[model samples]
Target: MRRIRRSIGEYINLYNGKRPHSSLADQTPDEAHFGTVRAINSGA
Candidate 1:
């Protein structure tokens, strides 16, 4: 049970703080949730 709980915690961390999602413009869920993304300006 402890191992399963630890695995679940790791998965949650990755899902929320590490893995980027296409629906979020490749931003991790934590970034999207916290509005911490920085915009890149390309010289046009």
Candidate 2:
């Protein structure tokens, strides 16, 4: 239960408000999800 709660918190931060994902070009996951992706060495 505790582990699950901790994972949920981590996910919320990583995918909703924190964690500058490289796929997002250093933007938060929420930004990427909302089409706010920036241009970086994405290999795209």
Candidate 3:
């Protein structure tokens, strides 16, 4: 159970942090995601 949980966490992180998105013009998830982060920061 512990091993399975760790594997799931790793997969989630990999997908959300490393995968690239065509919608973001070939940017990785991290960079594509940061646009939203920057927008929120600017709004605040």
Candidate 4:
């Protein structure tokens, strides 16, 4: 059960943090949600 939970958590993280979504202009969910903050922090 613990391993299963960890696997699910990892997959969720990947889906949100790494996988790009076409509906979101090919940005990952995290990128789509925090793009401006990221750009500002990076001095873009």
User: Which pairs of residues collide in candidate 4?
Assistant: none
Candidate with more favorable, higher lDDT: 1 or 3: 1
Per-residue lDDT over 1-44 for candidate 3, one digit per residue giving the tens place of the 0 to 100 score? 99999999999888777877788787777887788799899995
lDDT of 4 by residue, 1-31 (tens): 9999999999999999999999999999999
TM-score of every candidate? 0.77, 0.42, 0.62, 0.75
Pairs with backbone N, CA or C atoms under 3 Å apart (clashes), candidate 2:
none
- Give the CA lDDT, 0 to 100, for residue 23 in model 4: 100
Per-residue accuracy of model 1 over 1-44 as CA lDDT, tens digit each: 99999999999999999999999999999998777434333322
Show where candidate 1 strays beyond 4 Å.
Answer: 36-44
- Residue 18 in candidate 1 has what lDDT? 99
lDDT ranking of the models: 4, 1, 3, 2
**In model 1, how many backbone clashes occur?**
0
Task: Assess candidate 2 and give its lDDT.
Answer: 0.74
In terms of lDDT, which candidate is stronger, 2 or 3? 3
Poorest 10 consecutive residues by lDDT, candidate 1: 35-44
Q: Which scores greater on TM-score, model 2 or model 3?
A: 3
Stretches of candidate 4 above 4 Å error?
Answer: 36-44
Q: Provide backbone clash counts, one per model.
A: 0, 0, 0, 0
* Span of 10 residues, lowest total lDDT, candidate 2: 35-44
What lDDT score goes with residue 5 in model 3?
Answer: 100
Weakest 10 consecutive residues, lDDT, candidate 4?
32-41
Please give the TM-score that candidate 2 achieves against the real structure: 0.42
